[model samples]
Target: MQTAADREAKLQRHRLRMTLLSVANTSLQSVIIGLYAWAGEVGWSVAWRFFLVGAGSSAMFALIIWRGLNLRLKDPGLLLPQIALSVLIQLLFLVLAPKLWVLFLVAVLVTYNFAMMSFSARQFTLAWLLVGAASALALFAARGRFGHFGTSGVSIAILWLFFFLCIRQLTAIGTQFSSLRTQLSEKNKQLSASLERIQELASHDDLTGALNRRSFMQLLADERARAQRAGQPFCIALLDIDHFKTVNDRFGHLIGDAVLKEFCAVAAASIRVTDRFARYGGEEFMLLLAPSTSSDVARVATERVRQALEAHDWDRIAPGLRVTLSAGVSQLAPDESVEQLVRRADEALYAAKDAGRNRTVVA
Candidate 1:
């Protein structure tokens, strides 16, 4: 649902926040060093050297932030340059710390920042391993300056172990959340499909596979409304199978059912796909045609159904078996009610049956 503009705006806001954080962190470090220099706690030369390093690092980050401002033009996160810059920043911190043992804290901070990025677990693990190894090598190189391996050495090793455990725990939790999300998505899809199938069953007749009377009437109402608005003509036809009761009496209801289904299938093929067909009741049905007038177009559609039914191989149901339909087509008059139209069509159907069987009458 999110538009491209919305996503771009979100990325811009995130990049802005990252830029501000970088500025704030850099400024705080510079201020702290400046305070030490001003108070003479550290010599002005040493303080200035640290201040220069922080300022230079801040400038480098600012350059990256400048690139980030154009994030929409390119990727905004976890570029190789960004990763290298983060590593260089942590190395700067390691070099500036008074005690070599403090490298463990620097490693923890760097790992946390990397974990917050878009890296996969594999990438994070590989990067973290490299960082931890570098920290250990740096400590080993500085061991002579600090004399023997003491409590500080033990504390550094313990912190590294704790960091490793944290990473494993976080990875496990991430995997579980991913699995739960997939299951939830599949359940939502299945529920949606089930609801659709239920609706289809509710809307259609089981025997004829046509719209049920209720759904058909609803569709007719909609078509009527549309025709009224568009000043277009629409019509309905009521059809009945001739002597359907006799077929049931002579051949049993099973053969009668087969004849009804076959008649519907033939009529469906004869009508336009845009037309609506429905089983109105036993041996009765309705047809709705839109953008068409009653006498000519509607009559043609009914005639097609009548001809199709008469031509079909009804003898398959039983020897010498034959079936026919009587239909009445009525066009909508201006501002006519649905009941009035149906009643008129029903009257016409009765007239068709009275005059003769197997025929269509238009009203």
Candidate 2:
């Protein structure tokens, strides 16, 4: 089972990877900015300042996530804060280097595009509005100095190509994330099915599909407690297949297993829906009936199961094969404990076996 600590650790690891990816994105943007600075489109001092601030901010976020500090926040990914800071830095650089304003504008778009991968629709819309308002204010303040595509045609084309390539890369990353989410969803479904199968195996018999001995005992204990508390009476029946060893010795264990399965099916159909039935051990089964007024009711229910098995066609399985059951029924008494009640039922079962092979004895 996955505990809270394990889930938290997994989240931290994922967040760390995201932080590293953000840092790499910042480095890539810085590279482009450095290229512009080298070509004299933007001042070297302004380019270097932008690089320092952007990279420093990314590193700081990475450190916070790595140290498990972001767990304190509602959004542990720190996505909104990162987006806000990145946009503000780009806008600041836009003001500082208006000659390269177009590049910074593209950078702002790229940042929001990346945010789309993690942000909810509402968050994305809010971020978009805030960025739009901030961009308008910055443009108004630097309206007279805002640069256009006045550089050489080659330079303009190259910048345009670089921006397009960046957008394409972000699109690819989004696609990859979408695919991974789908795969994770499928894996979770398979995991749920596997867990359910494991639980069934733990509680039920593998061959007969009846409750295993351990699970049956647990149910018996619970029922006993409930019956005692409510001042009610329930009954237990210990049943054994008559001449089971002879059949197994004559026909082998495979046919013996088939007989066991078919007997359980008939017994289950004969009993009330609320009754519990289980395989106690080899060729021995136990039944816990719902609350009854007398041991006669319990005996009648057990007899129905015996008659059902006796009436079933055994020739289909093996020629001239026959099966019968002997059961012992014991009703809970006012002062009887679970172990004592089961012991009485067991003794009655032995009595029935001694008197005749195919019969039920009440105690």
Candidate 3:
């Protein structure tokens, strides 16, 4: 699970990267402005002013987001403010360097395009209206100074350079979107895997990988309902590892847990796939065998499990380790409740223990 702090930190890192990209964009524009100034098309002071204002605004936003100061805002990205400021700056430059109005106009469009990545449709519409109104006002105020495009070769070359930069910015945006898509896919897969693990933990024993008692009972009830409707027969067996406490005391709980796990594996392999196996409690297990009509069939199934465990190579686990199981098998009586059936099996299990530790008894 992602903690609040982790989510916040991730957001901060994303915002910081966006800020850096904004700064890089501003730097590119500043370079173009510097080039124009060097060619004597604009004053050096104008280039310096634009560079300082653009870079400083980006740095200010970065600091605010990084310091956790934007959390109170509904739109933590401050998309509107950034777009409004960028448009206003472009208009200012359009008025100051009217001969390069095309350059500044393109820059304003670039700003809107960048905003498209973060803005919702409604937000984008609102940003469009805001920029439209602000541009109208700024253009009106500088009506005489705003519309100049030279027919010189140098001007055409600069226009081509500006188009090339715009293409680069668009490509970068496409790459960012591609990266986000891949990340979303990976996160979705991780979420699915986490949900599967949660379901497994809820339904199965952590150590033996068999159904837990509660889940087993639920399945048993459902099975009983279906069986009663279809007039089918089924049997249940309660199994206990003989001398489990002694094994734990001599070899330690870890070894005891391993033995339990191995026993379940052997029992599962010995039983039919249609049967359901569960860990009833500590060192005790149960099996629900389906389509079984006779006590002889139930006893044979239980005996198979007992024989498999007894024949297992316990020497690989420990030099002197030996393991055995005793089981109690019970068939469903006519109209019998689940509780009664389980109780009868419990009694038979105790009887098996009382008689000899490594055998099966039927009820």
Looking at candidate 3, what is the lDDT of residue 285?
A: 98
Q: What are the lDDT figures for the candidates, one per model? A: 0.71, 0.86, 0.86
Worst 10 residues of 1 by lDDT: 98-107
Q: Candidate 1: give the clashing pairs.
A: none
lDDT of 3 by residue, 1-363 (tens): 899999988987887788777778888888888877776678898888988998779878888888888888888886677777878898888887777777887888888887866888898888889888877776776777654545578766766777898888888888978988999999999999999999999999999999999999998898788889988888999999999999999999989988988888898899987888999999999999886456888898889989999999998777799999889999888899999989999999999999988999998
lDDT by residue for model 2 (1-363), tens:
999999889879977887787787777777777777666666678757877899889989999999889999898989888888989998888887787787778878877776766788898788889999999877777778977544786567658766866776587578758877998999999999999999999999999999999999999888888888998899999999999999999988999999999999999999988889999999999999976546888888899999999999998888889999999999998878889999999999999999987999999
Q: Pairs clashing in candidate 3?
A: none
Clashing pairs in 2: none
Task: Summarize candidate 1's per-residue lDDT along 74-188 as a digit string, tens digits.
Answer: 5565344455554555555444543333433443454356354466778778877876777676556555544212345444454455455445545644774686689789989
Q: Poorest 10 consecutive residues of model 2 by lDDT?
A: 148-157
Which ranking of candidates, highest lDDT first? 2, 3, 1
Please give the TM-score that candidate 1 achieves against the real structure: 0.57
* TM-scores of the candidates in the order shown: 0.57, 0.63, 0.78
Comparison by TM-score, 1 against 3, better one: 3
Candidate 3 displacement at residue 240 in angstroms: 1.2
